[model samples]
Target chain A: MKIDKESIKKIAHLARLEFDENSAEKMSKDMSKILDWVEQLNEVDTSNVEPLTTMSSEVNDMREDKVGTHMSHDEALKNAPKRDSDYFRVPKVLE
Target chain B: MEKFSSFDEIKKSLEKKETDCRAIVEYYLKNIQTKAHLNAFVDVYEQSALEKADQLDEKIAKGKAGKLAGMVVGIKDVLNYQGQEANASSKILKGYISQFTTTAVQRLIDEDAIIIGRLNCDEFGMGSSNENSAHGKVLNALDESRVPGGSSGGSAVAVQANLCTVSLGTDTGGSVRQPAAFTGIIGMKPTYSRVSRWGLIAYASSFDTIGIFSKTVKDNALVMEIMAGHDEMDSTSSRKPVHPYSELLHFDKKVKIAYIQETIDSSALQPEIKENTLSVLEKLKAEGHEVEEVHFPLLKYALPTYYILTTAEASSNLSRFDGVKYGYRTPNAHNLESMYKLTRSEGFSEEVKRRIMLGTFVLSASYYDAYFTKAQKVRRLIKDFSENLLADFDYIIMPTTPTTAFKFGEHSGDPVAMYLEDLFTVQASVSGVPAISLPNGKDKSGMPIGLQILANSFKEAELYAFSNYITQITS
Candidate 1:
């Protein structure tokens, strides 16, 4: 259950969040403590159980193919941070 | 103007022409202004509320007002408000405006309920205390030095202070109920899929539910009925017919009730809370209702099960905020990778980052089965355990929280300690059953103790009726 700094860095990279060495160290300790506490769940005998991912028993598996309420072209682009007239502009990913 | 606790009282005043909708709105507005130090509202819509109230008053005069004509409501910051900022109390979405109104908010407005403002909450509803809000913490009106239990602390405080008739809050675990307990009011989380989650800002999607805070159970039921129907916007919304909960407030039947012996006898429980809870149980038995103390061995596992699933869900849900489409983008980001990392690091609070990291760790390929899969199985065990118990007993009763409102920063030093604040209320959320926190009498310090009740899923009418009856006899 011990979370090392390397694991912290790896998780942070995957989550797309960053922290300094000190904060990451603190996070590593916090996560280790939390995970250690969560380790108690292993005691419960869930071997015969199925994971209940969904809450509602009677949920519609599929939404209709028909169109529902949506924003217009201008409305969709209204909240973009670095947007041109039509598209949401972002930092270049490729060289 | 005198204070109004229920919509019925407000409606009576309107009927007698003693007070108009404008007058009601003005009274709440004045209260909001006078108690500005509580920091309940993130943004108050003065012009919009007044304008809507005047129009509703005109409609009332013509005898054509909608169901919630005289009701004033404040929404938690997470709900979409069309053009208003739906920040979720996070700096990432500080300037973001909702393009569409949430299905729940729209329904309230359609019923002629005037929305007074957006109330503050823990950032992305992540923290149990409101201290994590970027807009700053909400103070408990009853005890300013204490923490208002969160992530819906502001919503609870607004209703507690009479700043609004009823306020809407979202409960992923115990956000609504815990705060309602701290502030001493009625807080309810309906069955999962009972209310549409179309425009609600995502936290932990599976557990997240739009809840209500009100001074009276009838008022809570009235708002619950209007907000409970299925919507085309949310496929997860139940198509089950929503009962007119307000009209069914009479409970003449004797019901079987269960209280977890482990929870009541736990050393962590405040003595006053335990006494009040047992006292209520005694009252229930005196009334000839069956009250039993049940052993739920899995009660200890509910917290871990809740944390594992919610953190996993939250990490995925929060991935959408990468500084591309909206909200805060860092000025120093030179490329795509840095943009996402830097913006998020700068935007999110410490608690949020910790959860996202924990979620990522649990879902990692190497440990997925050990943490994520195992927790999911535990969740099933917990949910089924609750359902089976509820099958035999009509309800489960307990204190909403282990203690009354603690002073600020009491548990903030440790993340796990803060998570424990939800120990009592998480069972209802884990089960997706309807649960309510009725104001039990205050502790020795005069802080409120909440009496929580859990019932079978989709039994909101029965829950409301029982809760109403409990409040009456217990009060």
Candidate 2:
């Protein structure tokens, strides 16, 4: 519940975000305030309650397996920030 | 050409050949140009809109036009419109053009509605005020110093300024209704799964809903009718039959109404807002409707639960934008991990980063059950409590916001204060029920107050009819 510089570093890592010490301090304070506010939920007795992930009453939308049009390779690759031909180019991963 | 208030008037004029579609388009285009200072539109589709108008004029002549023929609409930046940018007011997706149109927007197009433009919004529909938009803050049409209430600020202001006949906005947490309230327009958020979320730039998949903003209830209902129903693209869209909501606006019988006693009497509520709400309730009571005060003790917890779950979903949803697939990429990365870190850090704004980090923290291995899972259970409790209230009462009524249109920089420095803006509006989002913000009246400062009304899930028809009735009597 206590968010500090160390916690911000850990969370920033998990979230793939980066912040310098100053911004991280600010973020830590903001996050602490928010987390503390949300901690009010502890007052409620949720022991017997089932976690509701979605509000939709219906279940899975089943369908017959059939070939249908989808985004072509070129169309899918059209928005790539860094693309080499058909593949999305990124920083060398295996290095 | 004369100014038209509703689509009904426009339809009448179109049929009589007094006002053609081109003329209507020109009228709105003029307004859009005149109100450019408001920063409502991210990109205006002027050429395409004019072409659509000419085509619709031909269809009108042939008497083969669709239901929304000649109706011009502005879509929120968060919803995708094919071949147009849907950046969601964030620099991260700065120039990203949508490959496919959103199901909701496509439905409007299928019914011959002209998409005038993509309006500005909070970055990925995150903020309460429109200040978080990278495009710039949308100025309230009535008062330039005040906010139009956001993440759908531009959407609300578009309709408010008559730049479009109606606009489409996504309400993750009162984005549509709150802005509508702020701008003195009608905003309605239909039940969860009522409208397909196929091409919506996801913030929180479960909480997000495509909503309508219009000057009139009938326009809102007409747009809702066209947009609602199941779509194969969105598995979450309900299979329930869509209603002709515009046609069912006749409400003859009195209904049971429950006003939350705590909310109306809360110290957070502005005096003018509380007075307007009470006056509306009194008017309804005078009209012979059964109105009673009820207690919703779980109202305070709805915001915390909403923030927790939505941030978790946003962190997951936003992970898709890792620089390689689409959107902004960092030029300073030499390694894969640093690429992600620097790209996300530089790409996203501070608020977005905070939410993503908080979401990661809550969903971290150590605190998953305490924050994420427990909040979900609390969410269930809140939803059940809301549905139980609606089971007895025909409608639950409250103020759309704790206050009216607030000044800019008022809550900008404090994220918690800004988050608290969704105080009165998040219950419907949390419960997945249909809720609407009808213009109650204006405050002393002349800013609008909204009377929010919620109904049982899938009861959009009832909600629209009652809203229509209220508008008729009150206006």
Q: Rate the local accuracy (lDDT) of all candidates.
A: 0.93, 0.92
lDDT of 2 at B191: 97
lDDT of 1 by residue, B1-475 (tens): 9989878899999989999999999999999999999999999999999999999988988989999999999999999989998999999997999999999989999999999999999999987779999999999999999988999999999999999999999999999999999999999999999999999999998899999999999999999999998787887889899999999999999999999999999888999999999999999999999999999999999999899989999999999999998899999898999999999999999999998998888899999999999998988888888999999999999999999999998998899999999999999888899999999999999999999999999999999999999988987
DockQ of each: 0.80, 0.83
TM-score of chain B as predicted in candidate 2: 0.99
lDDT of 2 at B250: 93
Question: What stretches of model 1 exceed 4 Å from their correct place?
Answer: A61-64
lDDT by residue for model 1 (A1-95), tens: 99999988888999999889899889989999999999999888877888877887664557659966588989888888889998999998975
Give lDDT tens digits, candidate 2, residues A1-95: 67989888988988999899899889988999999999999999988999997778879788778899867788788888888886999998756
DockQ score of candidate 2?
A: 0.83
lDDT of 1 at B97: 94
Off by over 4 Å in 2: none
